[model samples]
Target: MPRIELKTKIRAKKEIVFDLARSIDLHKISTEHTDEQAVDGKTSGLIGAGEWVTWRAKHLGVYQNLTSRITEFKRPDFFADEMVKGAFKHFRHEHHFAEVDGKTLMTDFFDYTSPFGLLGVLADRLFLKNYMKGLLVKRNDTIKEFAESERWKEVLSS
Candidate 1:
């Protein structure tokens, strides 16, 4: 199993940051490689626990479909989502938020295992690990930008 954990502070209210953190729309905007469409559930508006969204996107130029379910949620604080169906052998990600000096401290924790057993482990070491990290870095950088941008103000009000 591989675990990736990342934390960063965003200058915004916890609720605002947390909401944007889970927004599929924001995700599509942030991840340049992902073209996501919400299906089988609320595509827009607020998302909460028990909601499920299906998305199709291009990852590494390969189109993939994934369905994720919100397994746990506490508004403005934390949420957890697990891949119901996807490419990976196992994938579960948790998002956490906290307030600090009027800023939001956001954390992402992901756990996954590769499909090919020892071969998968070796493959991860050779490419997937760094690739995944770079992917996450890109995602977080976009998140930081969005959280600090004027657009997020509109997010705050809504």
Candidate 2:
């Protein structure tokens, strides 16, 4: 298994940042490469533990459909999503948020295992690891921008 962690500071409320990260619409916006939506779930509302969402998107030049459920949810603090079905042998992503001087410290923890054995390891070493990390970094930057945008302002104001 490979683990990738990224941290960023955002000038937003912890809850606000958390909500944005969990929003399927925001996720689609952040990761523009993937066309995804929350079918049979809240598309724009808060999601809690035990909640799940089904998403369809393209990966590795192939169309993939996956269902991931929220295994852990701590309001304004942390949440974890585990894949119910997907390409990887295992996929789990945890999002954490902490308030520092009224700003939010956001951390992302990604753990995954490729499907094939030694070939998977070699592929990760050759390209997948860096590719995945780069994707996460892009998502983080987009989230930072969206979290600080006027939409977040309206959400926080209300």
Candidate 3:
């Protein structure tokens, strides 16, 4: 298994940053470059515990569909989602938020295990880890941008 951790600071409220992190609409916007779309289940609003979402996207020039469920949730603080079906053997992503010095501190912990045993390990070491990290970074950057500006109102209100 490989674990990727990232910390981002947003000049915004924790509540706003938290909501933005969980918003399905915001995710679609963040991944627009990848042509990611929510094709089923809670496609537009804040995803909560026990809720699942199925997303289709283009990654590495291939189209893939991944379904994940929110296994844990704590409003304005933390949440964790685990892959129910996808290319990986397993994957779990945890999002955490806190208020620090009047700013929001957002952290991501992503853990994943690839299939094909040793071959998969080699792939992870060669590229998958960095690729996954890049995706998370892009997503967090979008959240920071939206949370810090009035643009958030557009997604949150709808």
TM-scores, one per candidate: 0.88, 0.89, 0.98
Please write out the lDDT profile of model 3 over residues 1-70, one tens digit for every residue. 8999999999999989999999999999999999999999889988898999999999989999999999
For all predictions, the C-alpha RMSD in Å is 1.9, 2.2, 0.7
Give every collision pair in model 1.
Answer: none
lDDT of candidate 1 over 1-158, digit per residue (tens): 88889988988778778878777667667664666667567576566799888777777679888788899998878999988888889888898998878888989898888788899999888888777777777777777787888776554455
Best by TM-score: 3
Worst 10 residues of 2 by lDDT: 149-158
Ranking by lDDT: 3, 2, 1
**Which residue pairs show backbone clashes in model 2?**
none
- Output the better candidate (1/2) by TM-score: 2
Q: What is the per-residue lDDT of model 2 for residues 62-157, given as tens digits with 9 covering 90 to 100? A: 778778889998887899999988788999999999998888999999999998999999999999999889988888887788788767654334
Candidate 2 Cα misplacement greater than 4 A, ranges:
39-44, 153-158
Q: How many steric clashes between backbone atoms does each model show?
A: 0, 0, 0
Deviation from native of the Cα of residue 110 in model 3, angstroms: 0.2
Q: Which stretches of candidate 1 lie over 4 Å from their true place?
A: 154-158
